[model samples]
Target: MNIKELPFEHVTVKALDIFNGYEISFVIENQTFHFLIGKSEELLPLNIKHYFKNQEHCNICQKMIFPTPFGQQPCLPLQKDMKDLLSHLRKTYVVLT
Candidate 1:
């Protein structure tokens, strides 16, 4: 499941404080489901791994970035997309389930 290949009709990404990661919530097969992933953690998914592996990491000294595995810092556009997803989720995330 490549992160980029996920046909996210609707999705939400929230940063997790206790674990220092993020939770991805979305609907699939008519069921609401969630997946958790952490930065610099062993449990990082293969999808994220594969996705980041194919991307170009930030080489410049000063720039907003989304850090990936092995000290790779990709730019912040991907992070921005995640924020947009969160906003979309909030519009429908009324129940605190």
Candidate 2:
């Protein structure tokens, strides 16, 4: 689906606090997703269809997140959110270019 088809809110013009950590969530139009920029909670309107892109890792979780298929990672189920996000990001960006 096109990025437009996937409803989202542009929560940031540019990420404000990477020091707190960053997470991009994907959600269905009628569902909910949780996004944590720092200690505060940001409720997203859509259900997370995925989680990470560009091989960016979670400093807290220390998981190999985003930009999958880049490294020979084992691909664990615990990181499903990350996996889904990576896939969606790849698809979206590849088409945009």
Candidate 3:
């Protein structure tokens, strides 16, 4: 499903620790959905926006330097971090119509 199709009205993000991880929460149709991200040891100089930007590439460096099973791909840490959250929401929280 397209993320744009989700009924999200607003989003809130909070830093987790000095390691530069974050917790992202979404407000969808008045209900709250949340997810946590751990620090990336591979990516140096972590930034908060990395957890929020909506793009296939890293918003900070604008480079496709991150490694993945697919090969060195565009940095999509936010997308990767949301994987479990999206699945959990799809299975238990989000009400599809």
Candidate 4:
């Protein structure tokens, strides 16, 4: 299915009092993916599709977050959401051409 067909949404944009510009959230499939955006054109993926039930370790934030992979791309909106993520990331950060 196409990305537009997926149930995607920009949940919120919070300052979060961090050095970065803001913490943006995109909700897809009941999962909240976070991104750190700077004042300029800087962006980093805090976590994507995190699985909190397991309470695993996250490499990015050094927190107990498990970034689960969107397996079986064709069956669901996994691939579409991943692709849409880049577009939002670009809006928050500089997409190096």
Candidate 5:
């Protein structure tokens, strides 16, 4: 399925497995949808307007750091709508929960 065609307004990372890939859940008009993104597909460059912050937690330093993108990060600037959606998701699902 094309990620761009997804009708979700908000999305959260439910789970991430190295073997199984990403388990993403999203909400659209109060309805929630769940889908799995394969490992190979997960690394693909997404055709979305979003800044690719390839930041990961540093175990030793305990700080968020941007990693070198080895063809694994999306490189684009986020549009207003995408930013709004991300903000909503962060506020409702990530920060709150």
Candidate 6:
């Protein structure tokens, strides 16, 4: 299914903590979209809930950097939209999972 086809207002993103940087996790009902952003480990809690609140100015970029055997190549531009969402934030490895 296309991310664009999904209800935009129903789409929600969350922040998860990783070793080197932060990971932004998004969900559309049961469907999940995960992206990793490079950032200093010092940024605790990552406060993704707040970041997504103002995702309009976001420009975070993502790639198929991770090995996802079970993952299908998403044609949905949600990743790009997400990149745009994190545009103002620090640069990081945005990997869609």
**Best candidate per lDDT, number?**
4
* Residue runs of model 4 more than 4 Å from their true location after superposition: 1-5, 41-97
Global lDDT for candidate 2?
0.37
For model 2, the superposed segments whose C-alpha errors exceed 4 Å read 1-21, 35-81, 93-97
The ten-residue window of minimal lDDT in model 6 covers: 49-58
lDDT of 5 by residue, 31-82 (tens): 3333334446333212231122455543222344454443222222222234
Better of 5 and 6 by TM-score: 6
TM-score versus the correct structure, for each prediction: 0.36, 0.28, 0.39, 0.41, 0.31, 0.35
lDDT of each candidate versus the true structure: 0.41, 0.37, 0.44, 0.46, 0.40, 0.38
Candidate 6 per-residue lDDT over residues 1-97, each given as its tens digit: 2333443323333454545555655544333444455556344322232223221222222333222333334423454455444542233323323
- lDDT of each residue in 1-97, candidate 2, tens digit only: 2333445443322233545344443333322233332323632212222244456444333565545344324323323454444445545632211
Higher-TM-score candidate of 1 and 3 = 3
Clashes in model 5: which pairs?
49-78
Q: Alpha carbon lDDT of residue 9, candidate 4?
A: 60
Q: Whose TM-score is higher: candidate 2's or candidate 3's? A: 3
The C-alpha RMSD in Å for every predicted model, in order, reads 11.4, 13.9, 13.2, 9.4, 14.9, 11.9
Alpha carbon lDDT of residue 71, candidate 2?
38
**What order do candidates take by lDDT, descending?**
4, 3, 1, 5, 6, 2
Q: Local error of candidate 2 at 12, Å?
A: 7.4
- What residue runs in model 3 are displaced by over 4 Å at the alpha carbon? 18-20, 42-81, 84-97
lDDT of 4 by residue, 5-86 (tens): 4455665667757575665555555545555445556444333344333444433234554444532012123323544655
Between candidates 2 and 6, the TM-score winner: 6
Using TM-score as the measure, which candidate wins?
Answer: 4
How high a TM-score does candidate 5 get?
0.31
**True-structure lDDT of candidate 3:** 0.44
